[model samples]
Target: MPVTDYQGSTSSPFSFGRSLLSLRRDTTAIMPSGEEADLEAFQRHVASTLAELLPAADAGAGDEFLSAAWIRRLLEAFVLCQEEFRVVVAQARRRAGAQLPVAAERMVAEFHERAVKALDVCNAARDGVDQVRRWERLADIAASALGAPGEVHEGQLRRARKALTDLSTLLVDDAAAASGAGGVASFLSSHRNRSFGRARASPSRTAVAGAAASASASHFRSLSWSVSRTWSAARQLQAIGAGLAAPRAHEAGLAAPVYSMGCVLHLTAWALVAAVPCPDRGNALQAHHLPAAPPRAAFPWAPPLLALQERLAEEGKRKDRRHSCGLLKEIHSLEKSTQKLAEAIDAAPIPLFGDRENDVREAAAELAAVCESMRDGLEPLERLVREVFHRIVRSRVDGLDSSMHNAD
Candidate 1:
C-alpha cells in the first residue's frame, strides 16, 4: 500500500506467502542465501537487488551495498506480485466447467477478475511501472487456462484477462452502431459478452450493431445544455466516450431543441425499443437475451414508476412496463432496437402521427410488416438517437454540477 525505500524503521522481516495481496504487501527483506543481516541491512540489500533485476540502472548507490539491498527488496516485491497474479488467474481459468467445489470455484473466479483489475490499476498507476511483455506473459498464462479440455474452461481465465485488456483500449469506437450510446457504467454493466474478442467492423451483424451502439455524442450538444435538478445532483459520473458522447455537429435530425423532461422520456423510449420483441432477420431481432438493467434496487426508474402508478389514480390501461429502465439494451429477453420504433406506433404526442388515433393503427400495421422483413435494419438509426439523448442528459447534469460546485 505504501511505497517506501529500504531505510530506517520501515524495514520488516522477510517472509513469503501465496496470496496475491499478501505477496504484494510483503515488506520483509532477506539477504541472498550466502548471508543474512539485520532488518535495515536486509532491506538495503533488497533495494539493491530490485534495481538490478528491474531494467533500471543501479543508480544512487552511494556505497553500492545499500543500493543492492534496496533493488533486491523491490525485485522481491515485484516477483511476489507476479506470482500471486499467476495463481489467481490460473484458478479463474479452472472455473470454466466441471463441478468443482463451490468454494474453490468462487475463490478462483474472484481472484481471476480482481487480479486482472488490480494489474490494470497498477499498470496505469505510474509510468515505467512494468514492461508490456510482462503483461503479455500473464496474458498467455491466462489463455492457457482455456486449454483445460472442455468448452467451459477452455480458457476462461484468458478470456477474463483479455476482456480486461480490451477495456483498457482507447475510449470508444465511433464508427460503431450503438457507438455513441453508452458510458463506462453502461459498457461494464451491459456489453461484456459482446466486447472483448467479438468486435466487428460494420453494422451488418449483431456484433457490429452492438459495438456501434456506443458511438458519438454529437447529438446531445445540440440540445439545450444547462441546469440540473435537485434530485439528480449527487450522482458522480464519469465522462462518456464517443459511443456515449453522441453529439451533433450543429446539424442533425430533431436536434433535441428543447430541454424539458423530454430527454428522459426519449431515453425511456429508447429503452422500450431495446426491450420489446421485434421481428428478426438471422435472429438478430428475435434472439432473446437477458435484460440490461440497473439491477434490483439500483433500478433507476423505481421512483418514476412508483410515481407513474400514483398518477394513474384509477386503474390504467395494460401492463406495458418500460423494460429498459435507463437504456434500451435492458429490454425483456425479447426486444430489438427496430421493434421499439415499430412499437412506438403507440408512442404519444397526438399530432405527430397524423390523425393521431388513425395513425396508431396504420403505424402499427406498417411496423409489423416492416419489422417482419427488416428486423434490426433500423437499429443503427435508433442507436444514434439514443446517443444524442444520452449526451443531452449528461450535459444537463454536468452544467448543473458545474454551477453548483462553483457557486461558492
Candidate 2:
C-alpha cells in the first residue's frame, strides 16, 4: 500500500470522531478534559515527526533513507514520542486521582518492559558503531599509504596491501558472525528487572568495556568474547514484541498512548538492529522478525511507520545487501569501495607502474572518500545511540518510581 501522508489523513489526530483518538476522548470523559487534549496532541506530534522520516515517493535510497542522518532522525522521533508518552501518562494519573486504571497501568508496565529491552539494543548498536570506526581506521591507513604523488614504491604498496588485508579480515569475520559479536548484554541483563526508583551509580564496567572495544583495529578478537556467543538481535527483538497487542475497547484513556509508544519503541529498536551490526542480524532481518504487523488503519502513525518498515525490508532482500555486515548506506559504500581497492591492490604487478599505478591510486581515493563519509557520520550516530540509551533508562526509572509512588 502507498504510504498515506499523515498531514492529509482524515483519521489523523486532528479530527477525533473516526479513529482511535475518538475512543480515547470517550475514555477520558471521566477525568479532566485537558488530559484528553494532551493525549491527542501527543499522537499528532508523533505522526507528524515520524512522517518527516519518510522519503519522497520518487526518491532513491541515497543518503536520506537509512543513512546515518536518517537513522538519527528516527531515534530523535522516538525520543520525542517517549518524552510525550511520559507526560501524557503522568497527567492521566493525576487527573484520575493519583492512579491510572488497572488496564492502563498494565499497559504502562508493559511498555516499560519493552523500554528495558531497548536499552540492551542501544548498547549493542553502540558496539556496532565502534566496529565501523575500527573499519574506518584501517581504511584510513590503507588510503594514506597510497595517497602520495608520483611513482608509488613497493613499501607503499605493501603497507596499503596489509591494511586492506586486515580490513578484509575484519569484514569477513563480521559477516561470518552474521552480526558483530560484541555488546554489553551481560552487564545490562543483571539490572534488567531492577526497579527504577532506586538510585545507583552508572556501571563503570560498561564504560571500561566500551573503551576496550574501541581499541586499535587489531583487537577485533576481543569483541567475540564481549557478548555471549548465543546472543541474537533477532531474539531480543522478538522478546520486545512478545505479548504486545492493541488495547481492548474497554482499556481506554492512557491505553492508546501506551500502545502507540510501545509500537514506536519496537520499531526504533528493530530499525537499529537492521541498520547497525548486532548478533545474528541475518535472522533479525527476516520477514517474521517483527510482531505481526499492527493494523495500519487503526492508528494515524501506522502509514509512515509501515512505509519505513517496507523500505528497509526491501533493502534487506537485495542480493548485494544479503552478505553485508550492516544495511547502513555507508556500510554498503564502505564494502564496495574497500573491495575495489582490495582487488586493485591484488591485481597490481609486483613493481607497479603505468595504468596499474593509476588504478591503485584511483581505488585508494575512492575508499578514502568512503572513509571520510563514515568518519563524519559515525560519531553523531554513536552519540544519538548513546542518547537513546540514557533516555530509555531514565524513562524506565521514572515509570517505576511513579508506579511505586502511586502504590504508596
lDDT: worst 10-residue window of model 1: 233-242
lDDT of 2 by residue, 1-408 (tens): 011211222221122113445435643463365766777777776787678888876655444788887788788778767766776787778778988887778778988988888777887888888888888888889898998787788778756755655566567667767743222222122222221112332556434433333353347656643346787889998998887787676766887788888778888998898897787887898878777666777778888878878888998888778777888989888887876776677668757888998899999999899899898889888877877776676677778888898789
Compose the digit string of candidate 1's lDDT tens values, residues 11-39. Answer: 22333223434443443222232212222
Reference-based lDDT, each prediction: 0.27, 0.72
Question: Between which residue pairs do clashes occur in model 2?
Answer: none
lDDT (Cα, 0-100) at 283 in candidate 1: 18
Give the Å shift of residue 54 in candidate 2.
0.8
Index of the highest-lDDT prediction: 2
TM-score of every prediction relative to native: 0.17, 0.80
State which candidate has the highest TM-score.
2
* Model 2 spans > 4 angstroms off: 1-33, 57-63, 179-218, 224-226
